[model samples]
Target: MPLRPVAALAAACTLALLGPSAAAAVALTPLPQSVRESEGSLALPGRFAIAWTGCREPMLERAAERFQRDLGRLTGVETFAAAGPRLEIACAAADPGALSLEAREAYRLQVTGEGVKLDADGPIGVLRGLATLRQLIETGPDGAAALPAVAIDDRPRFAWRGVTIDTARHFMSIETLRRQIDAMEQVKLNVLHLHLSDNEAFRVESRRYPRLHEVAGHGQFYTQAQIRDLIAYAADRGVRVVPEFDVPGHARAMTLAYPELASNPAGAPAAGAQVLNPASEAAYRFVTRLFDEMAGLFPDAYFHIGGDEVGDDAWAGDPQVEALMKTEGLTTKAQVEAHFHRRIHQALTRRGKIVVGWEEIIDTGTLPRDIVVQAWRTSNATARATALGHRTIVSAGYYLDLLNTAQFHYGFDPLDTSAAGMSPADADAARKLHPLVGRFVTDGVVVQPMAPLTPEQEALVLGGEAPIWAELVTDEMLDNRLWPRAAALAERFWSPREVRDTGDMYARLAVQQDRLRRLGLQDQAARARMASRLAPGASEPLLVLLDLVGPVRNMAHDKRVPAAIAGKKIVQNLTAMADAAPVDSLAARAFLARAERAASGEAAARAAVRADFEVWNANHRRVVAIAQDHPAVREALPISADIAEMAAVGLLALDALETGKPLAPETAARAKVVLDRADAFEAASARPIFSFFGKRPPADLIIMVTPGVRRLVEAAGG
Candidate 1:
C-alpha cells in the first residue's frame, strides 16, 4: 500500500513542467539574507523523495517527515518517504554534532531544473531550510507545483526571536498551544515563553501539590505530561519552550489553594496584601519545589520567575512581612521586592538554570549579572540592563496584545537606540539617579551626537520577543491576533536592518496570509463565522462593514466595554465591525489614492470608486432590515447607518466633481453638515454601554470613503 517516492517525484515534476512560466520566482517571507536567482526551476511532484547524505540525526529524519506531510497537504499530493536525488538534504561536514546556540543555523538552499538541494551545519539548520523550501513552493501559471531556480544563504539576525503566550489569563488548550507552536515554526520563531501562572489561574499542574491544579487552576490546567509533550513538539520545530511562574505578586491563584503562603491570611482585609508571603518559609519551600518540577519538564536552561508589578502595598499591611522587612533593614517596598528576587535567583542558580524576569527585577539592584531582564514597560530597559552587564530581551513595542498594526511593531528595533550622547560626568550621575538614563536619550537637538551601543553592550542584548498577553484574547481569536503580524515581527528579528520597506513587507504578507490559512490558521474564517452570527439573513453587509473598519487600538476596547462583560466571552462585546478586522488603515488609504487618480481622468478607477460607494449606500437598508429581527445586528445598527450615509454623501460629491460644477454656498454648507453628522454618529456609536462612566472618546473608525469624499467636496467648494 506504500507509494514509491520516485514515482511521486516524477509525477510532481511532470505536472509542474506542464505549467507555463514555471520558473517565476516566489516572493519569500522573512526574505533571505542573500539570494541569487537563476534561469531554471524545479517542478515538485505530489509525492516527492528526499535523498540524504550524512544527515542521520533523528531530528533531521523527523523534519523530513514533516516536510513530506506539509508538501502533500499544500499541493494535494500524497508524498512518501524514500531515498533519491530529487531533493537532496545533507550536512556541510561529516560530523554535524549536537544542536545548540553555538551551532550554526545558517543554511544554503539551491534549486535547479534537475532537482533541489538543501545544505546546513546541523539538524536545526536543516529544519530552517525546510521551512524556507515550504514557503518557496508555488503554483505555476498553469496551476502546477514549481520552485524557481535560486541559491539562498539565510540565517537569523537575532538568536532569541520569540513569542510569549500568557495562558494564565485565559487557559489555552494543549491543542491550541500546539497549533500556535506550529504557526511559530512557520515563521521560524525560536522561543515560546509560556506564562504559566497569574492572578486569574495557575495554568500548570503541580503533582507535588495536587491542590494547585484542583483548586487554584479552576479545573483548567495542563498536566506535567502535556507540558513535556509541548516541549518535545517545540523542540522538533527548533523552538525552545520557556516556562514562567510569576511570584510575590500575581499570586492570588496560588494563595487560594495554600492560604498559609499568602502574606495576608484568608478573610483578612489588608492593603497591598494580594501577594505571596515573602516572610513565610513555607512559601519559599513551595515555590522552590514547584519551580524544580516545572523546570525539569522544560529542557531549556532558561526559567522565568515573573518579578513585575509588585505593588507598594504588597506587604504594607501584612504584620509578618512588615516584621521581616524591619529585621532586614529594608526601608522601601522596592527593597523588600529585591530581597525576594535575590532569594529566588539564588535558588534557581543552585539548580543550574538561568533566571529571566521582567524590568522590575532589574530595578531591584540585587539580581546577579547572570540573570536576564525582559524590558516591557520602557524603551530603554534593554539598553539599561545590558549597560549593567546583564543580558536583556526587549518586549515593550512588541506587545501584540495592544492590537497595534504590524508596521508599528516592525519599526521597533532592539539595538537601534542607545545612551551615547550623555557626557561621562552626566552619564555616571544619571546612572546613580536611575537605571534607564543611559538607555534612552531625551527628545530634542543635542549638543553631542547620540552614541551607538558599545560592542560589549551590543553583545549583552540577546534579542527580543512579542508577548501576546491573553487578557482579552479567546481561543477563536488567537490565530487572527498573532499571525501575519507575527510573521512581520519574525522578519524584523531575522532579516537585515536595511530591510525596512513596509510596502514590500505587506506584499509578501498577503501571500503569507493565504498560506497560513491553507495551513489551518482560522483568521479569515473566524471573521466570516462571526459575521454570519451577527446577520444570518444577510451577512454580506456586516462583512463589508468589517472589511473597511478595524478594532480600535491602544486598549480602546478595554475602555469602551466593562471588564466583566468583555472577560466572560471573547465575542460578547465584539459585535462591532472593527472587532473582526486588522488595524492597518493602509487598504482604505490605497483605495482613496485610486479615487484621487480617478479624479485626474481615469475612467476605470472612477467606476471602481462609484461601484464600491454604491455597495455601501445599498448596505444601510439591508442592515436596517436585518436589525429589525436580529439583536446582534441591532447592536451595530448605528455605525452601519452612519457608514451608509457617508457613502451616499460621497456619491453626491463624486457626481458634482464629474460634472465639473462648483457647489452653491447652500449646497456646500449642507455637505459639511452631512460630514459632521456622520462623524457625530460614529462618536455616539462608540460610547460605552455604561454612559455614566464619563464622556467616551471618539471611536477609532476608519471610513474608507472619507478621504475620497472630502477631496471631491473640497474641489467643488463644499
Candidate 2:
C-alpha cells in the first residue's frame, strides 16, 4: 500500500469532535494512518464484555482477557463474559499464531454512540486495533470514562519497528524485559532485538556449553527456561525476539570462559585477546554448536551476530589469523573478517537462520546475499548493503544511550536518503539553539549523502531500532533511558515519513509516557526513587534539579569516567546527580518554549521565561545543601552553582532584551565563559585521554537550558 501523510489523518481533527464533554481529546502515538472523528462520544459500558468473533485461537482469547481487564481498570466497572455492552472483535481471516514481517496488522476501529467494532484480517491486527481502542478512551464531564466517536484505519509503516534491549552489560530481570515487551505492543513496536552476549558478559544461560554462562556470567544470566518464557511472552504480544551473540570481536567474556577459543596463543582475556580465534577448528565447533542450539531457543528467523568493532588489535599480527590469511588468500583485515563471517553465516543459515550482523559485516566479503546487516555507525551501511541486494536495518541515529532528546532522534529518517531528516539550514539552527552546551545533540553527526537506489533497493530498508546500550544504564534506570524517547522513534518506524512535527510528537509523547506508566512501567518511579536516595529528606529540590538538567550526552558517561576519575572499572552508582537526571529535561523544554516565544518578541512569554530563571536561581541553594551533606552525591555541588549562575545570567540577558539595550561586554564574556566551560566539560568526558578524562570533570550533568541563555545573550548583541 502506498503510504499517506502519517499524521494527516488527524490533521483535520479538533476538540469539537469530543462533543464538549471530553477531558483533553485523543492524541495517539504512531498516529493511525486514517482517522475521522465526529461530535459524539461512546460512554464505556458500566458492564462490559469482549465478543471475540475470531477463530478459536489462544492469542486472541488472551488478548481479550487483557482488554477486558484494561476496561475495568480504566472505567472502574467490572466486566464479564455475560455482558450488557460488547467490544466486538472480528478477525475471520487471521492466522492467530502467525507473527512475522509478512503478518497482516492493518485494522479498522469504529467507535460510535452505539459501541466499538474492531475489524482486522488477523489476530495481530486485532491486538493493534485494541491498542488504539485503549488510547481513544477519555474522561467525560460526568466523570465517567468514554470513547470519543471516531473511525481509524491503521497499520505500521515499517515491518521492523524494533527496540534493542541490552542484557549483556547489566543483566536485566525477566520481569524488566516483559515490562518493555508490554510497552512495545502498546505502541505498535513489533521487534525486540535482544543484545544477549557481549564483551562484558553472556546474559543467556547455555546448557550445551555450560562454561559460557557459568564462568562468564559472573553469577547473572537468564536461564533457558526463562528465555523460553520470554519468547512466548513476546510472541503473545506480537514481538519477535532476535538474539545477538557477538563473535570475532567483543569476545572478551566469551574467550574468558573458553580459553581454547581465544585469538591470543596465551589465551589472555585482555584487550588484544578480545576475539575468538576464527582460524581455530575449536572456535568453529564452539560457534556452530552454540549458535545452532541458540537458534532452537529463539524461533525468530533473524539472529544478530555482532560483527562490529573487529579491531586491528585483535587480528593485526595474530599467528593463527596470519597463517589462515596466507592460506585463504585473505590479504587484509577486512578479507580475514570475510572468511570468519562467511563461515559463521553459512553455519547459521544452514540451521534455518537469516544471519543479521552489524554494519561491519561487509568486511566479511561478499558472503551470502541473504545476510541482514544492521546499519549502526553510518548511512553508508545501508546504502552499500542494499546495493548488494542484502537487507538492512537502519540504527545510525537511534542510539538512545547517547542521552539525546526525543526530537533529535525522531529527525533521523531511515529512508530520507538526503540529510537523514535535517537539511543544512535546520541543523545549523539546532546547533545555534544550544551553542553554549558545545555538543548540542545534533553536533556530532557527519551526514553521509546516500546514492539514490532503485525502488527494489529502497525496499531493502526494513525500518530502524532505538538501541539502549546498558553501559550507563541498568534495570533501575533502563525505563527512563529508553522510554518516551523510544516512543517518538517508534513513531518514526511505525508512522509515515511525512509525520515530521516535533512539537506534536512531543505532545503525544507526554501522553504515551503517562499511559505506559499506568500500564505498569516504572521509569518515573525509578527516577523518583534514585532522587530520593540522593537527598533523603529533600527529594523535591533534587527532583526539580533533575527535571532542569540532563545527563551528559553520548558516550560521556562511560567506563573511563570511573577508571580515570574515581579509580574504578564501571560503577553503577544510582544516587549520583548523573544517575538522577533524565535525558529529557521537562523544565528545560518548558523554559525553552517560553524563551522561544520571548525571543520572537512576546510580552507574557518574557515574564514567564524570567519567572523560570528566578525559580532556578533560588532552587540551587536547596539542592546544594542536600548534595554537600551526602558524600555519595557531593559531585552535584558544582552543577548546582552553575545552574544558579546560568539562571542569573539568563535574567540579566532577558533584562537587556526587554529594555532594548545591549548586554555589557563584561557580562556577556562571563556568560560565555560559563557556557564554554559547560561545553568543554561535555567534550572532555567523551575523550579517552587523561588530560581530558581525569581533569576533575566539571559536574556529571549537562545544562539543558543553555540554548535559551546563549540565544538571549547573543540576541542582546553584546
Summarize candidate 1's per-residue lDDT along 551-616 as a digit string, tens digits: 655455664243333454233454445566665544554465556656665666677778878888
TM-score of each: 0.83, 0.86
Top lDDT: which candidate number?
A: 2
**How many backbone clashes are present in model 2?**
2
Against the true structure, whose TM-score is highest? 2
In angstroms, give how far residue 698 of model 2 lies from its true place. Answer: 3.7
Each model's lDDT comes to 0.71, 0.77
User: Weakest 10 consecutive residues, lDDT, candidate 2?
Assistant: 13-22
Each prediction's RMSD to truth: 8.3, 5.7
